[model samples]
Target: MDQTVSTVIDEDVCIGCGMCVKVCPVGTISMKEGRAAVTGKWSLNCGHCEAVCPVDAVRVMSLDKEQSAFGTFDADHRWLPHGEYDTVQLVRLMSSRRSCRNFKDEPVDRPLLEDLVKIGVTAPSGTNSQRWSFTILPTRHAVIGLAEKVGGFYLRLNRLAEKSWLRFLLRMVGKRDLEDYYHTYYEYVEEGLMEWKQKGRDRLFHGAHAAIVLGSKPGATLPKEDALLAAQNMLLAAHAMGLGTCLIGMAVEAMKRDRSIARFLGIPDKEQTFAIIALGLPDEEYQSTAGRKLVVPRYFEG
Candidate 1:
Protein backbone atom coordinates (compact mmCIF):
# COMPACT_ATOMS: atom_id res chain seq x y z
CA MET A 1 0.00 0.00 0.00
CA ASP A 2 1.09 3.55 -0.68
CA GLN A 3 2.23 5.69 2.26
CA THR A 4 -0.46 8.18 3.14
CA VAL A 5 1.73 10.24 5.46
CA SER A 6 5.39 10.81 6.44
CA THR A 7 7.39 13.25 8.59
CA VAL A 8 10.65 15.09 8.01
CA ILE A 9 13.29 16.59 10.29
CA ASP A 10 15.81 19.37 9.58
CA GLU A 11 18.96 18.44 11.48
CA ASP A 12 20.79 21.68 10.62
CA VAL A 13 18.09 23.84 12.26
CA CYS A 14 17.38 21.37 15.11
CA ILE A 15 17.91 22.69 18.62
CA GLY A 16 17.24 19.22 20.10
CA CYS A 17 15.05 20.79 22.79
CA GLY A 18 13.03 17.48 22.87
CA MET A 19 9.66 19.31 22.64
CA CYS A 20 8.58 17.02 19.81
CA VAL A 21 9.73 13.92 21.72
CA LYS A 22 7.80 14.97 24.82
CA VAL A 23 4.65 15.96 22.94
CA CYS A 24 4.41 12.93 20.64
CA PRO A 25 1.45 10.91 21.89
CA VAL A 26 2.65 7.71 20.28
CA GLY A 27 6.25 8.06 21.42
CA THR A 28 7.46 7.76 17.85
CA ILE A 29 9.91 10.66 18.10
CA SER A 30 13.23 10.19 19.94
CA MET A 31 16.46 12.12 20.26
CA LYS A 32 19.19 10.62 18.07
CA GLU A 33 22.47 12.33 17.18
CA GLY A 34 21.17 15.40 19.02
CA ARG A 35 18.21 15.52 16.56
CA ALA A 36 14.64 14.30 16.60
CA ALA A 37 13.88 11.14 14.63
CA VAL A 38 10.63 9.16 14.28
CA THR A 39 10.53 5.40 14.83
CA GLY A 40 7.72 5.02 12.28
CA LYS A 41 6.17 2.19 14.32
CA TRP A 42 3.31 4.07 16.01
CA SER A 43 3.17 7.30 14.07
CA LEU A 44 -0.44 8.36 13.45
CA ASN A 45 0.54 11.50 11.48
CA CYS A 46 -1.15 13.64 14.15
CA GLY A 47 1.35 16.55 13.71
CA HIS A 48 2.35 17.13 17.34
CA CYS A 49 5.95 16.86 16.13
CA GLU A 50 5.42 19.72 13.74
CA ALA A 51 3.41 21.85 16.18
CA VAL A 52 5.89 21.73 19.11
CA CYS A 53 9.05 22.46 17.11
CA PRO A 54 10.10 25.85 18.35
CA VAL A 55 12.63 26.41 15.53
CA ASP A 56 10.42 24.77 12.85
CA ALA A 57 13.00 21.99 12.46
CA VAL A 58 10.39 19.20 12.56
CA ARG A 59 8.01 18.89 9.63
CA VAL A 60 4.99 16.68 9.09
CA MET A 61 5.22 15.94 5.37
CA SER A 62 1.58 14.88 5.03
CA LEU A 63 0.36 18.39 5.86
CA ASP A 64 -0.32 20.65 2.89
CA LYS A 65 0.91 24.15 3.65
CA GLU A 66 -0.97 25.71 0.76
CA GLN A 67 -4.34 24.25 1.77
CA SER A 68 -3.90 24.70 5.52
CA ALA A 69 -4.67 27.86 7.46
CA PHE A 70 -1.72 29.01 9.63
CA GLY A 71 -1.05 32.35 11.31
CA THR A 72 -4.51 33.48 10.20
CA PHE A 73 -5.55 35.03 13.48
CA ASP A 74 -4.48 38.12 15.41
CA ALA A 75 -3.34 36.14 18.42
CA ASP A 76 -2.94 38.99 20.92
CA HIS A 77 -6.58 39.91 21.52
CA ARG A 78 -8.32 36.98 19.79
CA TRP A 79 -6.86 34.36 22.14
CA LEU A 80 -8.52 34.28 25.54
CA PRO A 81 -7.43 33.15 29.01
CA HIS A 82 -9.36 30.60 31.07
CA GLY A 83 -11.96 32.68 32.95
CA GLU A 84 -13.60 34.44 30.01
CA TYR A 85 -17.23 33.70 31.00
CA ASP A 86 -18.66 32.49 34.30
CA THR A 87 -20.19 29.03 34.76
CA VAL A 88 -23.65 30.48 35.42
CA GLN A 89 -23.78 32.11 31.98
CA LEU A 90 -22.74 28.88 30.25
CA VAL A 91 -25.28 26.86 32.25
CA ARG A 92 -28.04 29.28 31.27
CA LEU A 93 -27.16 28.97 27.60
CA MET A 94 -27.03 25.19 27.79
CA SER A 95 -30.37 25.06 29.57
CA SER A 96 -31.96 27.36 27.01
CA ARG A 97 -30.82 25.24 24.04
CA ARG A 98 -33.68 23.09 22.80
CA SER A 99 -34.81 21.36 19.65
CA CYS A 100 -36.91 23.92 17.81
CA ARG A 101 -39.54 22.32 15.55
CA ASN A 102 -41.37 25.49 14.56
CA PHE A 103 -39.91 28.51 12.85
CA LYS A 104 -41.03 31.84 11.40
CA ASP A 105 -41.52 32.44 7.67
CA GLU A 106 -38.64 34.93 7.63
CA PRO A 107 -35.55 34.05 5.61
CA VAL A 108 -32.08 33.56 7.10
CA ASP A 109 -29.10 35.15 5.37
CA ARG A 110 -26.35 33.04 3.79
CA PRO A 111 -23.63 34.87 5.73
CA LEU A 112 -25.17 33.96 9.09
CA LEU A 113 -25.29 30.31 8.10
CA GLU A 114 -21.69 30.59 6.95
CA ASP A 115 -20.77 31.85 10.40
CA LEU A 116 -22.32 28.73 11.93
CA VAL A 117 -20.27 26.50 9.62
CA LYS A 118 -17.11 28.39 10.53
CA ILE A 119 -17.65 27.74 14.22
CA GLY A 120 -18.77 24.18 13.64
CA VAL A 121 -15.51 23.16 11.97
CA THR A 122 -13.58 24.40 14.99
CA ALA A 123 -14.57 21.15 16.73
CA PRO A 124 -11.81 18.62 17.33
CA SER A 125 -11.48 15.59 15.08
CA GLY A 126 -9.56 12.33 15.08
CA THR A 127 -5.85 12.83 14.28
CA ASN A 128 -6.68 16.48 13.50
CA SER A 129 -8.14 15.15 10.26
CA GLN A 130 -10.81 17.78 9.74
CA ARG A 131 -12.93 15.79 7.30
CA TRP A 132 -16.20 17.69 7.82
CA SER A 133 -18.07 19.78 5.24
CA PHE A 134 -21.24 21.81 5.55
CA THR A 135 -23.87 22.53 2.91
CA ILE A 136 -26.33 25.28 3.63
CA LEU A 137 -29.82 25.26 2.16
CA PRO A 138 -30.46 28.96 2.66
CA THR A 139 -33.86 29.36 1.06
CA ARG A 140 -37.26 28.12 2.28
CA HIS A 141 -38.16 26.87 -1.17
CA ALA A 142 -34.98 24.85 -1.46
CA VAL A 143 -35.55 23.21 1.92
CA ILE A 144 -39.18 22.43 1.08
CA GLY A 145 -38.20 20.96 -2.28
CA LEU A 146 -35.68 18.64 -0.67
CA ALA A 147 -38.15 17.69 2.05
CA GLU A 148 -40.82 16.92 -0.56
CA LYS A 149 -38.45 14.57 -2.38
CA VAL A 150 -37.55 12.79 0.86
CA GLY A 151 -41.20 12.67 1.94
CA GLY A 152 -42.22 11.11 -1.36
CA PHE A 153 -39.56 8.45 -0.91
CA TYR A 154 -40.78 7.80 2.64
CA LEU A 155 -44.40 7.52 1.44
CA ARG A 156 -43.34 4.83 -1.03
CA LEU A 157 -41.27 3.19 1.69
CA ASN A 158 -44.28 3.17 4.00
CA ARG A 159 -46.30 1.35 1.33
CA LEU A 160 -43.65 -1.31 0.74
CA ALA A 161 -43.12 -1.78 4.47
CA GLU A 162 -46.80 -2.68 5.03
CA LYS A 163 -46.64 -5.74 2.78
CA SER A 164 -46.43 -9.07 4.60
CA TRP A 165 -43.49 -10.41 2.57
CA LEU A 166 -41.48 -7.23 3.07
CA ARG A 167 -42.15 -7.27 6.78
CA PHE A 168 -40.99 -10.87 6.95
CA LEU A 169 -37.86 -9.98 4.98
CA LEU A 170 -37.15 -7.04 7.29
CA ARG A 171 -37.51 -9.31 10.32
CA MET A 172 -35.08 -11.76 8.76
CA VAL A 173 -32.63 -8.94 8.25
CA GLY A 174 -32.92 -8.06 12.00
CA LYS A 175 -34.84 -4.86 11.29
CA ARG A 176 -37.91 -5.64 13.35
CA ASP A 177 -37.81 -2.21 15.00
CA LEU A 178 -37.70 -0.46 11.63
CA GLU A 179 -40.53 -2.62 10.29
CA ASP A 180 -42.72 -1.86 13.30
CA TYR A 181 -41.87 1.87 13.23
CA TYR A 182 -42.81 2.14 9.54
CA HIS A 183 -46.06 0.27 10.19
CA THR A 184 -46.93 2.83 12.87
CA TYR A 185 -45.97 5.72 10.58
CA TYR A 186 -48.08 4.32 7.73
CA GLU A 187 -51.15 4.41 9.95
CA TYR A 188 -50.37 7.99 11.04
CA VAL A 189 -50.09 9.26 7.43
CA GLU A 190 -52.86 7.05 6.03
CA GLU A 191 -55.49 9.71 6.67
CA GLY A 192 -54.36 12.29 4.05
CA LEU A 193 -50.99 13.22 2.54
CA MET A 194 -52.31 16.66 1.51
CA GLU A 195 -53.46 17.43 5.04
CA TRP A 196 -49.96 16.51 6.27
CA LYS A 197 -48.49 19.17 3.95
CA GLN A 198 -50.09 22.17 5.53
CA LYS A 199 -49.06 25.79 4.74
CA GLY A 200 -46.74 26.46 7.76
CA ARG A 201 -45.92 22.89 8.78
CA ASP A 202 -43.33 20.62 7.11
CA ARG A 203 -43.38 17.01 8.25
CA LEU A 204 -39.67 16.46 7.71
CA PHE A 205 -38.12 19.89 8.38
CA HIS A 206 -40.89 21.62 10.36
CA GLY A 207 -40.98 24.79 8.19
CA ALA A 208 -37.47 25.88 9.12
CA HIS A 209 -36.18 28.77 7.00
CA ALA A 210 -32.90 27.03 6.26
CA ALA A 211 -31.09 23.71 6.64
CA ILE A 212 -27.46 22.67 7.16
CA VAL A 213 -26.17 19.25 6.26
CA LEU A 214 -22.92 18.00 7.82
CA GLY A 215 -21.06 15.53 5.66
CA SER A 216 -17.98 13.36 6.18
CA LYS A 217 -15.45 11.65 3.97
CA PRO A 218 -16.59 8.23 2.75
CA GLY A 219 -13.82 6.31 4.56
CA ALA A 220 -12.89 8.48 7.50
CA THR A 221 -11.82 6.79 10.75
CA LEU A 222 -14.69 8.32 12.76
CA PRO A 223 -17.09 9.91 10.32
CA LYS A 224 -20.37 9.69 12.21
CA GLU A 225 -18.96 10.75 15.56
CA ASP A 226 -16.97 13.64 14.06
CA ALA A 227 -19.87 14.92 11.97
CA LEU A 228 -22.32 14.76 14.88
CA LEU A 229 -19.86 16.51 17.19
CA ALA A 230 -19.57 19.30 14.66
CA ALA A 231 -23.32 19.37 14.36
CA GLN A 232 -23.76 19.80 18.12
CA ASN A 233 -21.20 22.60 18.10
CA MET A 234 -23.11 24.34 15.33
CA LEU A 235 -26.40 23.78 17.11
CA LEU A 236 -25.18 25.30 20.36
CA ALA A 237 -23.53 28.15 18.47
CA ALA A 238 -26.79 28.85 16.67
CA HIS A 239 -28.69 28.89 19.98
CA ALA A 240 -26.17 31.28 21.50
CA MET A 241 -26.60 33.55 18.50
CA GLY A 242 -30.37 33.80 19.05
CA LEU A 243 -31.24 31.30 16.31
CA GLY A 244 -33.34 28.13 16.55
CA THR A 245 -32.14 24.76 15.26
CA CYS A 246 -33.17 21.11 15.19
CA LEU A 247 -31.06 18.01 14.57
CA ILE A 248 -32.87 15.74 12.12
CA GLY A 249 -31.61 12.16 11.71
CA MET A 250 -34.32 11.50 9.11
CA ALA A 251 -32.58 13.82 6.67
CA VAL A 252 -29.33 11.90 6.88
CA GLU A 253 -31.07 8.52 6.46
CA ALA A 254 -33.10 9.83 3.50
CA MET A 255 -30.03 11.24 1.75
CA LYS A 256 -28.15 7.98 2.24
CA ARG A 257 -30.88 5.86 0.65
CA ASP A 258 -31.36 8.07 -2.44
CA ARG A 259 -28.46 9.27 -4.57
CA SER A 260 -30.71 11.77 -6.35
CA ILE A 261 -31.51 13.50 -3.08
CA ALA A 262 -27.84 13.50 -2.11
CA ARG A 263 -26.85 14.96 -5.46
CA PHE A 264 -29.57 17.59 -5.25
CA LEU A 265 -28.25 18.61 -1.83
CA GLY A 266 -24.75 19.03 -3.39
CA ILE A 267 -23.25 16.33 -1.14
CA PRO A 268 -20.07 14.99 -2.69
CA ASP A 269 -20.56 11.58 -4.23
CA LYS A 270 -17.70 10.13 -2.21
CA GLU A 271 -18.90 11.61 1.10
CA GLN A 272 -21.48 10.31 3.58
CA THR A 273 -24.25 12.36 5.11
CA PHE A 274 -24.10 12.14 8.91
CA ALA A 275 -26.05 15.09 10.29
CA ILE A 276 -28.61 17.69 9.25
CA ILE A 277 -29.71 20.71 11.32
CA ALA A 278 -32.70 22.88 10.48
CA LEU A 279 -32.03 26.59 11.11
CA GLY A 280 -34.44 29.53 11.40
CA LEU A 281 -35.82 32.35 13.55
CA PRO A 282 -37.92 31.20 16.49
CA ASP A 283 -41.69 31.10 15.97
CA GLU A 284 -42.56 30.15 19.56
CA GLU A 285 -41.32 30.90 23.05
CA TYR A 286 -40.39 28.49 25.87
CA GLN A 287 -41.30 29.57 29.39
CA SER A 288 -38.78 27.28 31.16
CA THR A 289 -36.26 24.56 30.56
CA ALA A 290 -37.48 20.99 30.78
CA GLY A 291 -35.87 18.99 33.57
CA ARG A 292 -34.37 15.54 33.13
CA LYS A 293 -33.23 12.79 35.50
CA LEU A 294 -29.55 12.00 35.46
CA VAL A 295 -28.65 8.44 34.61
CA VAL A 296 -27.06 6.48 37.43
CA PRO A 297 -23.63 5.10 36.72
CA ARG A 298 -21.73 2.19 38.25
CA TYR A 299 -18.56 3.39 40.00
CA PHE A 300 -15.20 1.69 39.52
CA GLU A 301 -13.01 3.16 42.19
CA GLY A 302 -9.48 2.07 42.76
Candidate 2:
Protein backbone atom coordinates (compact mmCIF):
# COMPACT_ATOMS: atom_id res chain seq x y z
CA MET A 1 0.00 0.00 0.00
CA ASP A 2 1.38 3.40 -1.01
CA GLN A 3 0.44 5.47 2.06
CA THR A 4 2.92 8.29 1.56
CA VAL A 5 1.17 11.47 2.64
CA SER A 6 0.01 13.74 -0.18
CA THR A 7 -2.15 15.89 2.12
CA VAL A 8 -1.34 19.58 2.35
CA ILE A 9 -3.08 22.03 4.71
CA ASP A 10 -3.26 25.75 3.89
CA GLU A 11 -2.31 27.54 7.07
CA ASP A 12 -4.00 30.79 6.00
CA VAL A 13 -7.32 29.07 5.23
CA CYS A 14 -7.27 26.52 8.05
CA ILE A 15 -9.33 27.55 11.09
CA GLY A 16 -7.38 25.13 13.35
CA CYS A 17 -10.67 23.67 14.66
CA GLY A 18 -8.92 20.26 14.76
CA MET A 19 -11.66 18.56 12.70
CA CYS A 20 -9.10 17.37 10.15
CA VAL A 21 -6.89 15.98 12.90
CA LYS A 22 -9.86 14.26 14.52
CA VAL A 23 -11.03 12.62 11.26
CA CYS A 24 -7.60 11.52 9.95
CA PRO A 25 -7.76 7.71 9.95
CA VAL A 26 -3.97 7.32 9.81
CA GLY A 27 -3.29 10.29 12.08
CA THR A 28 -1.69 12.06 9.12
CA ILE A 29 -2.84 15.44 10.41
CA SER A 30 -2.15 16.68 13.92
CA MET A 31 -2.66 19.97 15.78
CA LYS A 32 0.67 21.65 16.24
CA GLU A 33 0.90 25.07 17.97
CA GLY A 34 -2.88 25.58 17.60
CA ARG A 35 -2.78 24.88 13.86
CA ALA A 36 -3.51 21.58 12.06
CA ALA A 37 -0.40 20.29 10.26
CA VAL A 38 0.59 17.24 8.25
CA THR A 39 3.03 15.76 10.74
CA GLY A 40 2.61 12.07 9.90
CA LYS A 41 4.77 10.23 7.43
CA TRP A 42 2.00 8.06 5.95
CA SER A 43 -1.66 8.55 4.90
CA LEU A 44 -4.45 6.66 3.19
CA ASN A 45 -5.03 9.54 0.69
CA CYS A 46 -8.76 8.94 1.10
CA GLY A 47 -9.66 12.66 1.28
CA HIS A 48 -11.48 12.31 4.58
CA CYS A 49 -9.72 15.40 5.90
CA GLU A 50 -10.49 17.32 2.74
CA ALA A 51 -14.20 16.50 2.89
CA VAL A 52 -14.48 17.20 6.60
CA CYS A 53 -12.69 20.53 6.51
CA PRO A 54 -15.09 23.44 7.19
CA VAL A 55 -12.90 25.98 5.39
CA ASP A 56 -11.84 23.87 2.35
CA ALA A 57 -8.23 24.28 3.37
CA VAL A 58 -7.18 20.64 3.02
CA ARG A 59 -6.23 19.07 -0.31
CA VAL A 60 -5.28 15.50 -1.16
CA MET A 61 -2.99 15.66 -4.18
CA SER A 62 -3.37 11.95 -4.91
CA LEU A 63 -7.12 12.28 -5.45
CA ASP A 64 -8.45 13.50 -8.81
CA LYS A 65 -11.03 16.32 -8.81
CA GLU A 66 -12.13 15.58 -12.37
CA GLN A 67 -13.52 12.23 -11.27
CA SER A 68 -16.46 14.03 -9.65
CA ALA A 69 -17.18 15.96 -12.84
CA PHE A 70 -19.63 14.26 -15.19
CA GLY A 71 -20.13 14.79 -18.91
CA THR A 72 -23.69 13.51 -19.20
CA PHE A 73 -25.13 15.39 -16.21
CA ASP A 74 -24.28 18.27 -13.96
CA ALA A 75 -23.01 16.88 -10.63
CA ASP A 76 -23.61 18.64 -7.36
CA HIS A 77 -20.11 19.20 -5.98
CA ARG A 78 -21.26 19.81 -2.44
CA TRP A 79 -21.27 16.75 -0.24
CA LEU A 80 -24.63 15.50 1.01
CA PRO A 81 -24.68 14.93 4.74
CA HIS A 82 -25.81 11.66 6.27
CA GLY A 83 -29.55 10.89 6.18
CA GLU A 84 -30.17 13.74 3.76
CA TYR A 85 -31.13 11.77 0.65
CA ASP A 86 -34.55 10.36 -0.17
CA THR A 87 -34.59 6.73 0.91
CA VAL A 88 -37.86 5.91 -0.85
CA GLN A 89 -36.58 6.89 -4.27
CA LEU A 90 -33.30 5.11 -3.57
CA VAL A 91 -35.12 1.87 -2.73
CA ARG A 92 -37.39 2.31 -5.73
CA LEU A 93 -34.40 2.56 -8.02
CA MET A 94 -32.82 -0.51 -6.45
CA SER A 95 -36.00 -2.55 -6.87
CA SER A 96 -36.52 -1.36 -10.43
CA ARG A 97 -33.05 -2.32 -11.64
CA ARG A 98 -33.66 -5.83 -12.94
CA SER A 99 -31.42 -8.01 -15.09
CA CYS A 100 -32.36 -6.84 -18.58
CA ARG A 101 -32.11 -9.47 -21.31
CA ASN A 102 -33.77 -7.37 -24.02
CA PHE A 103 -31.82 -4.38 -25.33
CA LYS A 104 -32.58 -2.01 -28.20
CA ASP A 105 -30.45 -1.95 -31.36
CA GLU A 106 -29.27 1.55 -30.48
CA PRO A 107 -25.65 2.03 -29.38
CA VAL A 108 -24.48 3.74 -26.19
CA ASP A 109 -22.36 6.87 -26.49
CA ARG A 110 -18.72 6.87 -25.34
CA PRO A 111 -19.31 9.76 -22.94
CA LEU A 112 -21.99 7.82 -21.03
CA LEU A 113 -19.69 4.85 -20.73
CA GLU A 114 -16.88 7.09 -19.48
CA ASP A 115 -19.22 8.69 -16.95
CA LEU A 116 -20.30 5.27 -15.74
CA VAL A 117 -16.67 4.35 -15.12
CA LYS A 118 -16.32 7.51 -13.08
CA ILE A 119 -19.39 6.54 -11.04
CA GLY A 120 -17.87 3.08 -10.51
CA VAL A 121 -14.67 4.37 -8.90
CA THR A 122 -16.74 6.31 -6.36
CA ALA A 123 -17.27 3.03 -4.49
CA PRO A 124 -15.17 2.42 -1.43
CA SER A 125 -12.07 0.22 -1.61
CA GLY A 126 -10.06 -1.60 0.98
CA THR A 127 -7.40 0.75 2.34
CA ASN A 128 -8.22 3.13 -0.51
CA SER A 129 -6.11 1.08 -2.92
CA GLN A 130 -8.38 2.22 -5.81
CA ARG A 131 -6.71 -0.32 -8.10
CA TRP A 132 -9.86 -1.11 -10.06
CA SER A 133 -9.72 -0.98 -13.88
CA PHE A 134 -12.51 -0.64 -16.45
CA THR A 135 -12.31 -1.87 -20.04
CA ILE A 136 -15.09 -0.42 -22.19
CA LEU A 137 -16.56 -2.03 -25.28
CA PRO A 138 -18.22 1.13 -26.58
CA THR A 139 -19.88 -0.17 -29.71
CA ARG A 140 -22.06 -3.10 -30.71
CA HIS A 141 -19.26 -4.41 -32.92
CA ALA A 142 -16.82 -4.37 -30.03
CA VAL A 143 -19.35 -6.06 -27.75
CA ILE A 144 -19.98 -8.77 -30.33
CA GLY A 145 -16.24 -9.27 -30.72
CA LEU A 146 -15.85 -10.01 -27.01
CA ALA A 147 -19.02 -12.09 -26.94
CA GLU A 148 -17.66 -14.30 -29.72
CA LYS A 149 -14.57 -14.99 -27.64
CA VAL A 150 -16.67 -15.96 -24.61
CA GLY A 151 -18.93 -18.13 -26.76
CA GLY A 152 -15.88 -19.91 -28.19
CA PHE A 153 -14.59 -20.63 -24.70
CA TYR A 154 -17.91 -22.16 -23.68
CA LEU A 155 -17.99 -24.16 -26.88
CA ARG A 156 -14.62 -25.70 -26.05
CA LEU A 157 -15.75 -26.33 -22.47
CA ASN A 158 -18.90 -28.07 -23.67
CA ARG A 159 -16.80 -30.34 -25.83
CA LEU A 160 -14.66 -31.34 -22.85
CA ALA A 161 -17.79 -31.89 -20.78
CA GLU A 162 -19.16 -34.13 -23.49
CA LYS A 163 -16.32 -36.56 -22.92
CA SER A 164 -17.67 -38.92 -20.26
CA TRP A 165 -14.36 -40.72 -19.85
CA LEU A 166 -12.49 -37.46 -19.27
CA ARG A 167 -15.04 -36.39 -16.64
CA PHE A 168 -14.65 -39.73 -14.83
CA LEU A 169 -10.84 -39.53 -15.04
CA LEU A 170 -10.78 -36.09 -13.53
CA ARG A 171 -13.16 -37.19 -10.77
CA MET A 172 -10.97 -40.22 -10.00
CA VAL A 173 -8.14 -37.77 -9.17
CA GLY A 174 -10.45 -35.97 -6.66
CA LYS A 175 -11.27 -33.14 -9.05
CA ARG A 176 -15.02 -32.92 -9.47
CA ASP A 177 -15.14 -29.54 -11.21
CA LEU A 178 -15.55 -31.05 -14.66
CA GLU A 179 -18.19 -33.46 -13.49
CA ASP A 180 -20.08 -30.76 -11.59
CA TYR A 181 -20.00 -28.39 -14.57
CA TYR A 182 -21.18 -31.16 -16.84
CA HIS A 183 -24.12 -31.94 -14.56
CA THR A 184 -25.03 -28.35 -13.78
CA TYR A 185 -24.44 -26.33 -16.94
CA TYR A 186 -23.76 -28.67 -19.84
CA GLU A 187 -27.31 -28.75 -21.22
CA TYR A 188 -27.95 -25.02 -20.71
CA VAL A 189 -24.68 -24.05 -22.34
CA GLU A 190 -25.31 -26.43 -25.19
CA GLU A 191 -28.62 -24.74 -25.95
CA GLY A 192 -27.06 -21.26 -25.70
CA LEU A 193 -24.22 -22.19 -28.01
CA MET A 194 -26.68 -23.68 -30.48
CA GLU A 195 -28.78 -20.53 -30.41
CA TRP A 196 -25.67 -18.42 -30.93
CA LYS A 197 -24.34 -20.47 -33.84
CA GLN A 198 -27.45 -21.71 -35.67
CA LYS A 199 -29.81 -18.78 -35.15
CA GLY A 200 -27.32 -15.92 -34.68
CA ARG A 201 -28.93 -15.19 -31.36
CA ASP A 202 -26.76 -13.53 -28.73
CA ARG A 203 -27.23 -15.59 -25.56
CA LEU A 204 -23.94 -14.42 -24.07
CA PHE A 205 -24.58 -10.68 -23.89
CA HIS A 206 -28.31 -10.62 -24.69
CA GLY A 207 -27.73 -8.20 -27.62
CA ALA A 208 -26.48 -5.37 -25.44
CA HIS A 209 -24.86 -2.65 -27.55
CA ALA A 210 -22.13 -1.93 -25.01
CA ALA A 211 -20.27 -3.60 -22.18
CA ILE A 212 -17.89 -2.75 -19.35
CA VAL A 213 -15.39 -5.26 -18.02
CA LEU A 214 -14.46 -4.53 -14.40
CA GLY A 215 -11.19 -5.78 -12.95
CA SER A 216 -8.51 -5.01 -10.40
CA LYS A 217 -4.76 -4.76 -10.82
CA PRO A 218 -2.32 -6.78 -8.74
CA GLY A 219 -1.85 -6.01 -5.00
CA ALA A 220 -5.44 -5.02 -4.20
CA THR A 221 -6.32 -6.11 -0.67
CA LEU A 222 -9.88 -7.13 -1.55
CA PRO A 223 -10.01 -7.10 -5.31
CA LYS A 224 -13.18 -9.06 -5.94
CA GLU A 225 -15.21 -7.28 -3.27
CA ASP A 226 -13.95 -3.89 -4.40
CA ALA A 227 -14.80 -4.65 -8.02
CA LEU A 228 -18.24 -5.96 -7.07
CA LEU A 229 -19.07 -2.84 -5.03
CA ALA A 230 -18.01 -0.67 -7.94
CA ALA A 231 -20.09 -2.86 -10.25
CA GLN A 232 -23.23 -2.31 -8.16
CA ASN A 233 -22.68 1.43 -8.37
CA MET A 234 -22.38 1.24 -12.16
CA LEU A 235 -25.47 -0.95 -12.39
CA LEU A 236 -27.63 1.48 -10.44
CA ALA A 237 -26.19 4.48 -12.21
CA ALA A 238 -26.82 2.86 -15.58
CA HIS A 239 -30.44 2.23 -14.74
CA ALA A 240 -30.84 5.84 -13.67
CA MET A 241 -29.30 6.96 -16.95
CA GLY A 242 -32.17 5.29 -18.89
CA LEU A 243 -30.11 2.26 -19.80
CA GLY A 244 -30.56 -1.40 -18.98
CA THR A 245 -27.80 -3.53 -17.47
CA CYS A 246 -27.10 -7.21 -16.93
CA LEU A 247 -24.16 -8.98 -15.33
CA ILE A 248 -22.67 -11.57 -17.67
CA GLY A 249 -21.29 -14.11 -15.22
CA MET A 250 -20.50 -16.52 -18.03
CA ALA A 251 -18.11 -14.01 -19.55
CA VAL A 252 -16.47 -13.54 -16.17
CA GLU A 253 -16.12 -17.31 -15.82
CA ALA A 254 -14.65 -17.58 -19.30
CA MET A 255 -11.99 -15.00 -18.52
CA LYS A 256 -11.22 -16.73 -15.25
CA ARG A 257 -10.86 -20.17 -16.82
CA ASP A 258 -9.09 -18.99 -20.00
CA ARG A 259 -6.46 -16.30 -19.63
CA SER A 260 -6.32 -15.86 -23.40
CA ILE A 261 -9.78 -14.27 -23.34
CA ALA A 262 -8.48 -11.54 -21.02
CA ARG A 263 -5.43 -11.11 -23.21
CA PHE A 264 -7.71 -10.80 -26.26
CA LEU A 265 -9.60 -8.02 -24.47
CA GLY A 266 -6.28 -6.14 -23.95
CA ILE A 267 -6.20 -6.68 -20.18
CA PRO A 268 -2.77 -7.16 -18.63
CA ASP A 269 -1.67 -10.60 -17.44
CA LYS A 270 -1.69 -9.70 -13.74
CA GLU A 271 -5.09 -7.98 -13.75
CA GLN A 272 -8.03 -10.18 -12.65
CA THR A 273 -11.51 -9.51 -14.02
CA PHE A 274 -14.43 -9.65 -11.59
CA ALA A 275 -17.50 -8.65 -13.57
CA ILE A 276 -18.78 -7.95 -17.11
CA ILE A 277 -21.72 -5.54 -17.39
CA ALA A 278 -23.79 -5.64 -20.59
CA LEU A 279 -25.77 -2.45 -21.04
CA GLY A 280 -27.77 -0.51 -23.65
CA LEU A 281 -31.13 1.14 -24.25
CA PRO A 282 -33.83 -1.22 -23.00
CA ASP A 283 -36.38 -2.87 -25.25
CA GLU A 284 -38.48 -4.20 -22.39
CA GLU A 285 -40.48 -2.66 -19.56
CA TYR A 286 -42.29 -3.79 -16.40
CA GLN A 287 -45.39 -2.57 -14.55
CA SER A 288 -44.18 -2.87 -10.98
CA THR A 289 -41.26 -3.84 -8.76
CA ALA A 290 -40.65 -7.56 -8.33
CA GLY A 291 -40.82 -9.34 -5.01
CA ARG A 292 -37.89 -10.98 -3.22
CA LYS A 293 -37.69 -14.09 -1.06
CA LEU A 294 -37.97 -13.28 2.61
CA VAL A 295 -35.09 -13.83 5.01
CA VAL A 296 -34.77 -13.48 8.78
CA PRO A 297 -32.06 -11.31 10.25
CA ARG A 298 -29.65 -12.62 12.87
CA TYR A 299 -28.26 -10.62 15.76
CA PHE A 300 -24.68 -10.96 16.92
CA GLU A 301 -24.80 -9.85 20.55
CA GLY A 302 -21.15 -10.71 21.11
Instruction: Compare the candidates by lDDT and give the number of the best one.
Output: 2
Q: TM-scores of all models?
A: 0.77, 0.98
lDDT of 2 at 275: 99
Q: Whose TM-score is greatest here?
A: 2
* Candidate 2 per-residue lDDT over residues 160-237, each given as its tens digit: 999999999999999999999999999999999899889989988999999999999987899999999999999999
Tell me the TM-score of model 2. 0.98
Q: In candidate 2, which residue pairs clash?
A: none
Q: lDDT of candidate 2? A: 0.94
Question: For residues 87-162, what per-residue lDDT tens digits would candidate 1 score against the true structure?
Answer: 8988878888999988998998776787787778767777656788788899999888788878877777777867
Supply candidate 1's per-residue lDDT for 184: 71
Off by over 4 Å in 2: none
lDDT of 2 at 217: 95
Candidate 1 has an lDDT of 0.78
